[model samples]
Each structure stands twice: as C-alpha cells, then as structure tokens.
Target: MVSTAPFEEQAFGRYRLLERLGEGGMAEVFRAKSFGVEGFEKIVAIKRILPRLARYRDFVAMFVREAKVLVRLSHANVVQVFDLGRVEGKGDEPPAYFMAMEYIAGLDLATMLTRCQQVGVRPPPGLATYVAAEVAKGLDHAHRRRGEGGQPMGLVHRDVSPQNILLSWEGEVKVTDFGIAKARDSFEVNSEDSRVKLLRGKYAYMSPEQARGRDVGQDTDLYSLGVVLYEILSGANPFRAPQPLETMRRVCQADAPPLERLVPGLDPGLVAVVRQAMAPLPSGRFVDAAAMHEALLPHLSARHGRFGPSDLADFLRRLSEQLATNRVPVSEKTPIAAPSHLTHDVDHDRTDVDLPDRDDEMAQASRLLVLGRDLLLQGDLPRAGDALGRVLVMAERHGASAQASQARMYLGYLDALAGLPGGEALLRDGLAEAAAQGHRAGARQGRFLLGRLLENIGLPRAALVEYEACRRLAITDDDPLLATECDEALARLA
Candidate 1:
C-alpha cells in the first residue's frame, strides 16, 4: 500500500488534505476540503514543488509564472485555479509553492488509455470528433486570451500532453496544467534554435519544429494535439522509439502512420484532419483550432441525421415504438432480422409534458404530437419536445383534453426519456387525469407506458405496479396482445 503518511492533514492550513490523488516527479497532489467557506468541499489537486528545485530561482520563477498564466484564462473546458500561494513552513519544511485548482473527477487521457487496455475497449466513432471539438475550444480559449492592453497575450500551451488533458466524469474534456507554457514575447530565446531544444514537454507528442530545436509557433501545439488525437484513436503514438534520441529523430524525420489503415472504418474526413494537423510543415496544418473543427464537422455529426441529445432520444423512442408495435411495419423481404443497433438513445428517459388544451385543441395536439414523433424518429428530441410541449401551451391557451389523453401519454413518454428525476411522477399525474376521463384505451396505454417509463428510470419495482395495472386494463378493454405484453413485462421485472 502507498502509505497515507505523505497525505496526512495539517501540512497545509485551511486546506485540509483528505487523500493523495496523484504524484508527478516535481509535485504531489491531494484531494482536499476547504475550511474557508460553508459547505465548500472540493477536490483540489495540490502540486507541492520539489525542495531541490526550490533553490533554482529560474525554475521557481517559471513555475509561479505558469500558475499566474493559468489563473487568467477561465473557460468551461479549461481547469480553474481557485488560489495560488506559497506554503509557509520552517527550515526543513521546504519553501514549496502550491497551486489549488478545480479538482477534475476523472482520469487524464494517459490513464484513460490504460483503462481502455484493461477493458479491451476502443472509443466509439463520433467520440473522437466530439473530444477534439471540446479540446479545440479549450485551445482556442487559451491561445486567444488577451490582456488589459487589448493585445493578444500570445499564449501557446507548448506542452499539450495527455497528462495535462483531463476528462471529467460528466463527459467534459478539459485542458489543464499550463506549466512550461510560453508567452509570445516573454519567452527568453536562449539560442537560434533554443525554442526547439529546450525539451519542455513529453517527446512522444512534440512537433517537428519542437523536436528539431527550431522556432515554433501556435502550429506546434496543433501538431502536438494531432499526435494526441492519433494516439487516442489508435492505440499507438504516431512517433515512438526504443530510446530518447531515436524518439526525437522519429519526430523530426518520420511521417505519421496512416490512421485509416490502422483503425479501419474510421472516418476518412477525421483522418484527413489529423493528417493535415500533424503535417511536418507548420504551414500545411489548419490555420487555427476553429478551422480544424469546421473541417471535421461532417464526420463528427451523427449518421442518418445529426441532432442534439434531446432530439435523438425522442427519435429513438418513437422509432422503437414504431418498429416494435408494427405502427410502421418493415417488410419481411428485408434481410436484416430487425433494425441494426447502430443508433443509441443518448438521453433515453427525458419527458417534456405540455399543458392541457381546448380551442382547435385536438388538431393542434395532433399536429404537435405528429411533429414530436417525427422529430423523435429523426433523433431531434428538443425540437420534438418543443413541438410536443406546445400542445400543453395550446391547451393552456385555449382549456382540457384537446389532446384526448393520447397526447398526454406521448408527452409523458417523452418526459421519462428526458432523464428528469420528477419525470415519472409527471407521467403518473398524466395517467391519473387520463384514467379520470374514462378513456380505457388511453388508460391502458398510459399504464403500459407508465410501466415502461418506470423501468427505464431504474424504478423496476414501481414499474411492476404499472405493468400489473396495464394487464388488468388490457383484459377490461379486450386487448389480448397488450395484456400478453404486460404479463411478459411483469415477468421480466419479477
């Protein structure tokens, strides 16, 4: 066991250390809690500077300067620094500098890759584009950050390594640890080619200019980012070597391995972007991160059609119903057993139930419901929900049952798929109103749908109540298949 002795609290006042999260050669990080504010608990990664390096004035100045640079650029995808201070301690205590940054509750890309190796999993197709887009946003924020003089700070993250990129639990890709970064005018040019020879970041991700000790610019970071992307999509680095010298040589002289050949079926457009970004010559790459995003936009989007999570969820739900219930039957002449499982229910259980209606209500409700279902089939849930949700707005605009309870059921289903905690309750409320109207088919269908909603949201036991109710309603309404389905669902739940 890595002893917790190094991580014990009381080393730093106010910031109570909880557990050690990570350690680099120069710094030790901890999961910490702050005593400064009420209910202000956070995972703060503390990088305590090495005592040996403390004596070196240049390294200490550089370290603190980097922290200041990071504090100024605050974007959603960039890690935030709450505070930066010197850890005051006695003679042997080591005059350490610490940076308290927003604790990212996820692994760095390097660690994520190790997990992928452990689980034997490859990243999904669109995931690379999505991740690249987010990272580009972070890069864009950092690259374009300006000063009070209204001049570009000319900041470029020279070290864009997997270790510095964090993936949050919420699927957010964040760029962090801007240590060793260079300001356009601030960086001291040691030699004619000192820019390339300094060796600030990991060699595996270095650009050709960086490797060859040549003058580097923003395109260097772009090249490094391309290498990271290549490594992420394919399991191997674009340039690898058995020795340090060999690695540098490969970075200078080698061509990036053809990604398409390695990761077959990979998006050719994405491969092209990576190829252009990783070009040996800086001028060959995209002018900026935004340009790269635009280039890969087509490949990053969803196949069949592109839609947001809400829209996609609605589409999948409606598609499921249509195919499963024979509402829009597929021909047996088709070779496939069923629709290929290529599509996913990204936000499967989010429902957006609208208000009740009266004037031209049924027609309005029908149109909205049709629009919602069409949007759902096309994988556009937000617009679908917006269209469907307007049914209630129409109802409120006019007065009740403009949708004839069926609209409520469809809207309720949408609400559940939306992943709202209160969505099931809303569905049940709709079911109660539906039952009160004595619409047996609606009641039966509502109960059946309620069971499905419950099941989807991890309320399997509660779903049984709906399933059983659906079974009884089916029997009362002479729906044999529905009753059978209810019985089967109950059995599955059991």
Candidate 2:
C-alpha cells in the first residue's frame, strides 16, 4: 500500500524513496528501496532532518550525534542506520540532510493502540509482557553497548513514548527514534541554557525530572517506560490532565490513580508492578526497564493459562459495577431525612429495596460473569458460551442495567469469538444500549469491538471511526499497539 501524499522520488545517495512513513519531532521518515548491488534490493527507511529545526545548533548537533550513536547499536530490536549524507533533488535548492536505514514493516505503538481501540481489544498479558521484554532487550543492549575507550555507553532513551516504539506486525517490538538519546560519553549540557524551561520529549510520558528539565539519568527512562507499561496493562494513563502544563504538574506531584480504579478485578499483581514502576520517587521505582519487566513476570506467566468466556464476562461485570458505583452522586448517598416513621418507610424502600436489590443483582451477575470468565480463561469455549448464555437470561429477567449491558456485551463477545450466528447484530445492538445508557467507557469498548468486527468485514474506514471514538475514551496509553494497527488499517484504506 502507498500513501496519497506527494514525496520526492529520491533523497540523498543510493536511496530511492517509495513513500512517506511518518514524521517526528526531529525528522520525517520515508520508505525507500536501497540502490545496493544487483540482486540485493532492500527496503530501508530514509529519515531527513526537519527543515524547521535545521537552524538550531543544538538540534543539528543532536541529529549528527544520533547518526553516529545509531551506528554503534547492533541489536535486532533497534532499527539499523545504514548510511548518512546530504542530497539535492533535481532543480531543488539546498540539499537535505538524511539518513538511510532499515525499514520496519510494522506500526509503531501509537498506531497499535489505535487499532486495538478500534477493535475493542487489548493484547493478552503474556503478549504485552513479551513485547515489553523485547523492548527491554533492545534498551539493555543499547545501554550496555561499549563506546570509545571501552567505557560503558550508559545510553538512556529519554523519550521512550509509545510513538517512538514500534510493535511490528510480525510480532516484534523495536525501539526507534533516538534523536534525544542521552549517551554518557557523547552529550554535554549547555550551562547557558540551564535556566531555560524546555520540556523535552512527549509531555504525556515524561518522568518528573524530565518534565522539570532537570538532569536525568537511566531512572528517568525507566520511569517513562514504566508509564508505558502501565498504559499497556491497565488501559489507562497513570497521570493525565486537560493541558500540557497541568499534566507536567501532575507528573511532578500527583499519585497515579490506582489500577483497580480504572479496570477493576485486573490482576492485583500487575497493578503492583505498574505502581512500583511508576513510583513518584526515582528510588521507589525500578532501577531499570529489565527490573520492571521482572516485576511483571509472574503475572505474565499466569496469563498464559486459558481464559474462558465466563471469566472475561465476570471481569467486565465487576469492572462495570465498580465504575457505576463511583458515579453515584455524594449527595444521593448522604442521609436524606431525619428518622421518622414515614421517612423510615421511604428510606427502607430506597436503601434496602432499590440499592441493595441493585447490589444483589450486580453481585449475582458478577458471579455468573466470573463463571463465564473462568470457563473462557480455561479455554472451555462451549461451556463459557453456555455460562454467558445464562447471564444473558438473568440480566433480561432482572433488568440489571450494568449487568445487562455487560451480559449483552459478553454474549456478543463470545459469539464473535466463537463465530456463532448473528454475532454482528448482537454486538451492534449491545453497543447501542451501552451508548444510550451514557456508559462512555462501555460505549468506547463496544465501539472498539464493533470497529474490529467492521474491519473483519472489510470496512476499514468505518473501523477507523470506531477507533477514533475509542481513543477519546482511552484512560491510558496502554494498548498502543492496537491503536497503531488501526492506523495501519486506515493507511491501507488510504
């Protein structure tokens, strides 16, 4: 597939551009075929320095340094930089400074997340961990790579945001774009600019020190990557605000909202790993990305076990109930009236009748959902389907809004996964109800699932719309791979 945007055919020496891949803070990447020896045609990425930043001495210095640093990195997970030069197009003015390198045929983490949101799916825990492990292996390699004088490179990827991480379609996590990489031997801070407030890297993923533009070390990268890991596991950002300044302030001071608060019944072990990795103090967090991965190892291993439909359903049910309960107005929960016989009767009906009854239904529905989850988790598809089937009946009979919505959603999920009859219609109807109830989260999830369904049906454009909605409701940057895939899908359509 090719992009519709116009691009030069050739840039720099020995590289004929094919299409524009993407643009970043420092460079614009393009897909190009290397004009290597005969019988050896290779697809490489050609990254040209952005014209706007060319005049900045420090920025240009960083670009040149990045090219040199990249040559030293020989890891499989790091995109290889092959050649660098300046090139002038036919009749074009000043030459463009560009680097030709290996081209990864996969979407970056950002696109993956968008795709996942479109499809209403999060990668399984084991897969997410496996991806993380790959990234860690790459980072570890770069960090440990020896420089001139046989000294430790001590390379820190100060900007480890999802956009900089590529989760290839072939199931590999490759870290890319190291323009701001901090290598112990190569970088020197400019004292004159020390007082300048320059918020480097993506604000959303910045560590406290990075946000504050203070001297940062490997721990800063680790903390940033921890935020990435947190997003992948919990599907929510640890710290977020409406504006960049506010978000930076939160990164500097606020505690991350608990994982259970976003997705209840998530493995507590996973939450602990994420929380520990994202600790406010550098000392409180993992010493490195490898340590962060180690913290999540146990949970990742456990996730390998089968997940039945019932277990998934139960998880969603419990999660939904928790979310709904959190929505109850504080005033509504306050004591309504003085204790009189008439007030007592009304109170009894409201509290005991309505609230407890709702609670009972939620509990019952949650149990049934759990049963379904266990069955699904265990890979008992038929039994899981049967379990969810029962919840569907109960939800319809008892009029449990949260449970009913959940049950419908699960039933739709199982049917789609099972390739059962009328699954699309079922999912569509459930999504409508979820939307009508103003369950934005539920609606977001539903749209994601629906978008995936649409994609399966060859409706990529519709799927993109669904993913866009999903992103609006995304609580965290977790599942970027899914979003990236959605973008890839859209790209295909484009």
Candidate 3:
C-alpha cells in the first residue's frame, strides 16, 4: 500500500498534494488542492517530471515547450493548462518542473473499456462517434492554433491513445497529454535525435507514417483518432498485433481487416468514414481533423437523435451504477502493520506496507496489482516489475490464488517487454489457474498476452493457436475488444 505521509506534507507551488493519482515513466500526477484568498480553493491535477528525469536537458526542454503551447489552448474538449512553473525541492535537491491542469473527475477511455468489459456492455455507437468527433474538434483547434504573431502553429498531437482521452462524469470528452506534441515553434533542440531516441506514441494507435518514422502532420492525428473510433465502435483496434514489431509492420502495410468483418452489422457509411480517416497514405485520408469531424457529425446525429454531452452523461451514470455494485469491494478493515522487509520506499518517500493477515494482504495485493499495471502502461518497467513481484509474493502467501494468477499474468507481460525467458510458463500457468477459477476475463487476458509473447519470440504458428483460442473465448464471453484483437492478430498472421 502507498503511504500517505509524504504526499500529505508536500506542496508544489500553491497546490497542496492530496494523493498520488497515477504515474507514468516521464512524470507523476497528483490530485492537489489549490488555494487562494477569500476561501477560494479548487482541485487540480499537478503533473511533475520524475526526479531522475529532471536532469535530462532534452526532456526538460520538451516538457517546458509543450507546456507553453498547452497553456495557450482553451477548448471545452481539451484539458486546460492553468499554470506551469518549477517547484523548489527540499534541501539542496534540484527544483522540479510541474504543470497544474484542469482535473478531470472521470475515467479515461481505456478504463471505460475495461469497465464495459466488466459489465458486459459496450457504449452505444452514437455515443462512441460523439466522443471521437469531440476529440477531432479538439485536434482541429490545436492543428489550427496561431502563435504570437498569428502565424500558424501547426501542432500535431503525437500521442492520441485511449489513455489520453478522458470522459468526465458530466459527459465531457477532453483530450490531454500534449507533452509529446510536435509544433512548428517547438523548443526541442535536437528534433532528429529525439525522434530517433524514442517513439512518441502507443504503437497500436500510431499512423503508418509515424510507425515508419516519417514526418507527420494533422492527418496523423486523424489516423490515431480513427483507431480510437474503431476501438470504441467495434471494441478493438484494427491494426493491433501480438508484438510491437508485427503491429508496426501491419500499420505500415495498412493490414487491418474490414470493420464489417468484426462488427457484422456496422453501418457502411460509418465504416467508410473510419476507412478514410485511417487511409494508408496521408494523401488518401481526410485533409484535416475538421473534415473528419464534419463527416462523423451527420451519422452521429442521424442514429442517436441529437446526441450530446447530456446523453453521454446519462449513459456514464448508468454504467457507473452498474459497476459500483458489480465490482469487488476493497476490504475496509484497518490496515495491519507492515513487515520490516516490505517497508522499503518505492517513490516520493512513500514506503510500501505489508499487512498482518490474509484478508489485509489480499487487499494490499489488489492495490499493488493496480499500481503495477499503471506503471507498466507508463513504460516504467523496472518499478512495475517490482510492484507486480510483490503482489505475487503477497498473494501466494495469503492463499489468494486468483490474485496470484493475475500477478503472474502481468509479470509475464513484463518479461516479454524485457525480452526475458519464462514468460510463456508464467502465462500458461496463469491461464490455467484463471480457467479453473472460472475467471473468463483473466483467462482471455492471459491468452492475449501469451499470444503477444509467442509472436515476439518468432513462434508465429504457436501464436496463431493462442490467438484463435482467445478469439473463441472472446466470442463466448461476449467481449468485443478481445474478439477484435484476435481478429487483427489472425489477419496479420494470415
């Protein structure tokens, strides 16, 4: 469990840190309360560069430069950047860079997808279209932004995955994470080196040009948005593969299966819209984000009768209610004292804790599992591995077999990421355990991850078997995302 001591006492500028919401490789986010005179207080999200990364001049410059552009953006569909500055660290420590932005009190698209899987329902097609269209509107704004001299800024959001698309409880769709965005006036000192050193966005959502390391413009963002739309409407990414290299290959070749093949009754016109947005060549795609947004509007309005934020808000409210009752409740019993060995610090002076009994240990294990997953998504592999390892140990010791299997599944993915051996064994064991326990979701995830690992290891035939198995499981379990993923993988292998 994360200790609240450090965060409770920390203050970045006028924002008093309340809790560590989540973290990624480059930065950590905190839910903070900003103070002002006359009892004025507002909750905000404070994103700060990781301490170790602060010393990297290139990354620091990019962070500041991105903040400059973000601060100038104001749109209902975009998260507003309120303040950007450096906070002095304690003692002789170097100052930390931070940006306070509008805090969104809702789930990201990824989390919402998971929630949908849990509840056995997907968002309505109209609602999905609306969300994607809203994102396109935001991208259009950034794409057409002007500089101090009213010159075109030519901003391109390099990263436009589900994680960066937030859906508020009030049904607001907001696009965030401009940290990797490319703009005409960017302050990046070494653009070529930066591009070569790191791939900016998620591989599954990257455009063909981006996957090929070529120059990207507004069209690239539209392509990424198309992927998001496809996932939302059909419950899967069309170009996704079991491995990054394979996924990139499929992307470069534009090898996604037709939408109707996955979502059998999907509207042909809607499919055409997505196809145009995700066209293999930039020249074949929509001219800009605005054109794409306009194309989606008529379809959205026709199918869902004046669909808007209120309609989405109502849908989300219902989903939340369903999830509230369906989700496993975390143990509310007081946390036991931590064992000496488990008391080591993890980050921001926050120490880990070990509970005394099985119930408490299981609770702690669950929390650690979520923490590890978040870290993994953020590309902090080392810390993610450590957290998942702890979960495995704790779950095993407490006789939480199902939880242990979950931990093993993630550990297997980490192994694949590191190109280490034994990932197959871990996934196989986890899959068996999940199956025995009737955990369909866990079982499907295990198969999916295993397929990825197998493909990455040059075992294409074996990967096909796993993907086929997952496809069957997805169909039986009514999981569109898993089914779509399997379809994409099968298409690549074919």
Candidate 4:
C-alpha cells in the first residue's frame, strides 16, 4: 500500500523517521533509525506530539514531564525511554516534541488478544498468567520507586490498558506509557485546571478510585492490572459497559461475571486471584503488585509444567506467523518500504498493514475523524471543528450511524471547550445513539465527557445525575476508572 511506503527519509535530530508506524489521539509514532559512527545503527520507536499539541505550553510540559519520569524508571519489564528533545519542524512548521524509546519487535497485548480471537485459539493458560505476572512485576517496580534522597516517589501508572503492555517476539513483556502517571516528585502534578481533564486513564481499565477522580496510589494500579489479567484470560474486559456511566457503576460495584462462566474450565484459584485484585475497595485487594505476582506464580507452574521464556517466545513467533498468513492483504496503492538498517521481523512487519479497508466515503469519513481528533488534542479548535463537521456530514450521507455519533461527540467536546451552545444536546444525542447501537464503549466516553462539560458549566445538580449514572454503568461494566471519575465528580458537588 502507498501508505506504507517511506515517502522520504526525514531527519529528526540524530534519528531518521523511516516509516510511519502508528497514530494515536495525542501523538504519531514512527519506525526511526539512529545512526552512530562505525556503522552502529539502532532502531527506535519515536513518538512525536502532533504539531498542534507541541505548540501548547501545557502539552509540551506534560510531554517533558513524561520523559523525566521515564528516566527514573529502570526495570526489565518496563520499556526504556532513551532520549527526549524537540526536533525542529520543516519550513513554517513548529518544533515537534519527541521521545525515543526502546522498540519492541512484537504486538501489544490488545493486538495479541485480537489475534487469538480471530484464530479461535485461547492463549495457553500459563502464558496468559505469565504475561500478567510480568506486567505486575513492572508495576511493582514503579509503585515502590524511590527518589534521589531515598524518599518514596509514590509513582502510580494511571493508565494500564492493553495497548500500553507490549509483548516482544523474544517473550519480553514490558509496561509502557507513563505519560499520565502520577508521582509525588514528578515534574507535573495533575490539577483541576490542567489542560487535560482530571480523568487520565482508559475508562475500561481504570480502578474505582481513579474513575472517581480520587487520589490514587499503588492499589489503583493493582486494580487496573487485575483488569488486564482478567481480559488476558477471558478475552473480554469484565467491566466494559455500553456507556461511561454504566461502566462507572460496574466498577464501583465490582460486579463482573464469574471468570469460570466466561472461560469454561478456568482454574478456580486463578479466578480468586482476579477477584481479589479487582475488589472495589483498596483494602480488599492485594497488598501490592508484588503480592499479586506471587499469587500468580504457583498457578503458572501448575498449569503448563516447566514453561518459561523460551516457551512464550516460541508460541509468540508461531502465532505471529499464523496471523500474518491469514491477514487481509492491503491495497497495492499504499506501498511501505522499511529502512535498510531495520530488520524485517515478523512481529514488526505484521503491524505494517493496519490501513482501513472500506469504500471511499467511509474511508474519507474515518480519516476526517482522526484528523479532527488530533487537531482537537492539539488545541486547534476552529480547524478541528470544521474537520469534525465534515466527518458528521460524510458519515450521515453514508449511513454510518456509529461514525456519525462519534463525530457528533467530538464536535460536542469542541463546543464544550469553546463555551458554545448545543454542546450538551450534541453530547446527549451522541450518547443515546451509541447506546442504541450497543456501542457501550463509545457511549461511556460520551457520558464521561458530557458529565465534565456539565460540571464546567456550573450545573452541579445535573452533573451529579450524569456522574451517578456513569458510576452505576461503570460498576455494571466493572470499570474502576469511570466509577472513580463519577465518585470524584459527585464528591466535588458534595
């Protein structure tokens, strides 16, 4: 596919952006190559904040803060951040803030789950537990991290979703994305007036305390890690509701269906571990991530007899091959060529063909939505508003109700930020449409945003109602993050 092709070798400091690897709401990642004297070349993943965000002082501060935090976190199970600085933009473009990190030649836990679902294969029980255990170890390190003077850093990784956990072909599991992490000694502490809202993590994976916008500690990270473990074993998040409010409700109630019921023949002991880790109240959970890791070790030993890193490596490699062979071919129009210095590993190459496959109108709408989201994150309100408007028009014309709802939600967010009219109505309509379509995740997001907007507009009573609804939904969906956010909003009202 033409999208895969390296249009040109673009230099950013010593690193050359060889190919676009992926894009997210806040940043774009590239497969970059850094060269040194005597033919020393290293491949790194370069995450650059979008142009719009890079120009914002608040966003720039957050990016720099993330780098500072990562620099202090040294652990085998945590992805290392190698370098951080600004790369001068081309022509009239602004300087781009970038971070060079260790590149794992493998898929994230989320993609691995999708692969397992597509192949109708449950990952080996031992492997699943092992991966989760490794993640817990990483969390333990972060939770107990100390500062230069031996003072407790009190670091809590607010975001611990599947996308942040990477599993390499060599069987290394690393936890990443401390961008929203909270630590006492960190350069930036999250405040109510922060550019980004108080709620920081993925809604589905947040702990109850986090969801409520309450102060989080090590236990919060444990709860999220438990959610990750549960999904790894069952291939579904326990508290994934159709609406943010519902998800919050589920998280508050800790009302996940029994694991054995979801995955038949799952070990009872394993289920117990998950239940304890996911307990709504912090006191009911594991003492720390270390304790959770200890709990899982025996289970791993019992299920798959003598399995180790090599076993995981072999399984991942085989799975990668199988997935590649069965993957849908991308259009020939978007050809991608890897940099000569980079090795063509199966795990890396497999992610090269993630382009959308749809009709022209749908594809165009999707592109517009992404552009709108990126622009919004970067604080380009007017341009983002226009792009989102186009998305809504295209989606409505194409009868893509879900896409239309999403566009409406983005526009609503923009309006809310801009203190414009129709924000509440647009958000409500979007949430209702998402719920009608069984897009619980989307609905959940909409509700959360709406609740925040209402609060910002001094509608405490209305905001409380929305937050309460979100808390209930979060509990039903077993989402601690949403639940905690609701709790926090409700607390503020109190």
Candidates 1 and 3, the one with greater lDDT: 3
Give the clash count for model 2: 46
lDDT of each: 0.65, 0.62, 0.76, 0.74
- What ranges in model 4 sit over 4 Å off? 1-7, 179-200, 325-494
Error of 1 at 243 (Å): 1.0
Q: Give the range where candidate 2 is weakest over 10 consecutive residues by summed lDDT.
A: 330-339
Better of 3 and 4 by lDDT: 3
Assess candidate 3 and give its TM-score to the true structure.
Answer: 0.65
The number of the candidate with the highest TM-score is 3
167-199: candidate 3 lDDT, tens digit per residue: 999989999986454521232334555643332
Error of 3 at 190 (Å): 15
Task: Judge candidate 1 at residue 59 and give its lDDT.
Answer: 65
For candidate 1, the per-residue lDDT at 475 reads 93
Residues 1-494 of candidate 1 have per-residue lDDT tens digits of 33556655655766877788766645667778776466766657766665655655676777788787778989987888878888766866667778888888766778765443322224444555666677788888878889878898777777787888887655677888764544212334356755533324577788888877677787788888888888777755756643566568668864555777556667777888889989889989989877876776776566545423333233334333333443211111011111123353333232221222243344434444544544543445565565556556554445556253555666667766876566667666777877787767667877887787778769999999989989998898887757866886888888
Worst 10 residues of 1 by lDDT: 329-338
TM-score of each: 0.58, 0.59, 0.65, 0.63
Q: After superposition, how far is residue 125 of candidate 1 from its true place, in Å?
A: 2.3
What ordering of candidates by TM-score runs from best to worst?
A: 3, 4, 2, 1
Q: Give the TM-score of candidate 4.
A: 0.63
